[model samples]
Target: MPKNVLILHASPRLNGNSQTLAETFAAGAEAAGHWVSRISLAQAQISPCQACGYCRGHQHRCRLEDDMDKIYPAILGADCVALAAPLYFYDWPAQLKLAIDRLYAFGPEYSIRDKETVLLMTAADQNPQSFGGAEATYQLALVDYLRWRDRGRILVGGLNEAGAIEGHPALIDAYKLGYTI
Candidate 1:
């Protein structure tokens, strides 16, 4: 069956390494007859969550309006969600982190649960430990807390320059992950 896959491309650079991976993944998923939607976080207008507890009282509707208003519906309708971003300070970018925090609106009543998720991360550091923080966030928040299933992850390191991951094998892995998901 065809599935709805939402990819959140959180790279600062428009044509950066991680965006390449995300586009390649989208290609493969489309080839496999799945519906794919992608959002560039750098081009989005998302605000940080205020933690005002408005959603809890307002029937899961966030009080502040921004790009998350669109993202929330996308997430609710998606069967799979993919996070593609470069590692920043050994973890996800602050923009992506803020977007994730805004998801607190979906709570005990309406929640994002049981969805399949994928991670495509790139880092300039070659050290495997560089991805530890991002991986931990993915595992704990998406998998454990939201109960989303892990589709796959492609962590590409040692990529510093723009378009560095163009000819990389991680792109192939990302494509396969999308197709197989």
Candidate 2:
């Protein structure tokens, strides 16, 4: 079945390595006949969650008025959601974190339950432990609590320079992963 995949690209840099991987994954998904859409956080005006309990009411909608309004619909419509970002200080970029926090609006409605979640992460270090933080977040928030299916993960490391991720084996792996979806 062709799936609607929503990829959230959270690299602050234009054409950053993580963003490139996201493009590659999207291309592969599209080639496989799946519909893919990408939201670049660098260009979006999303705000962090205020931790207010407004969404907990019967509305099931976020009260904060921001660019996240554009994202919520895509998130709800997607059969698969991929979060792509470079590791900054052992975690994803703050922009992505903010959007993620805002997903609290969906909790009241369980809108994201049963969705397939994929993680696309890049880091400057080659150490495997560098990805622990994002993985922990995925496991705790998406997998354990939200009950989203764990689709797959592509973690590319030791890439700092712009476009350094090109020609890397992981890029092909990412494409293949998406194709299989």
Q: Which candidate should be chosen as best, given TM-score against the real structure? A: 1
For residues 1-181, what per-residue lDDT tens digits would candidate 1 score against the true structure? Answer: 9999999999889899999999999999999999999888878899888989999999899999888889998999999999999999999998799889988999864468969999999999999889999999999999988899998989999999988987898888888888888
Please give the range of 10 consecutive residues that has the lowest summed lDDT in model 2: 105-114
* Per-model TM-score versus the true fold: 0.97, 0.96
- For all candidates, the clash counts are 0, 0
| Cand. 2 Cα-lDDT | 0.89
Could you tell me how far off, in angstroms, the CA of residue 48 lies in candidate 2 after the best superposition? 1.6
Q: Compared to the true structure, candidate 1 yields what TM-score?
A: 0.97
TM-score of 2: 0.96
Clashes of 1: 0
Name model 2 segments beyond 4 Å from true: none
1-181 per-residue lDDT for model 2 (tens digits): 9999999999889898998998888988999999999899878998788888889984778898989989999898999999999998998789889998888888765767979989999999999899999899988988888888988999989998998998999999889888987
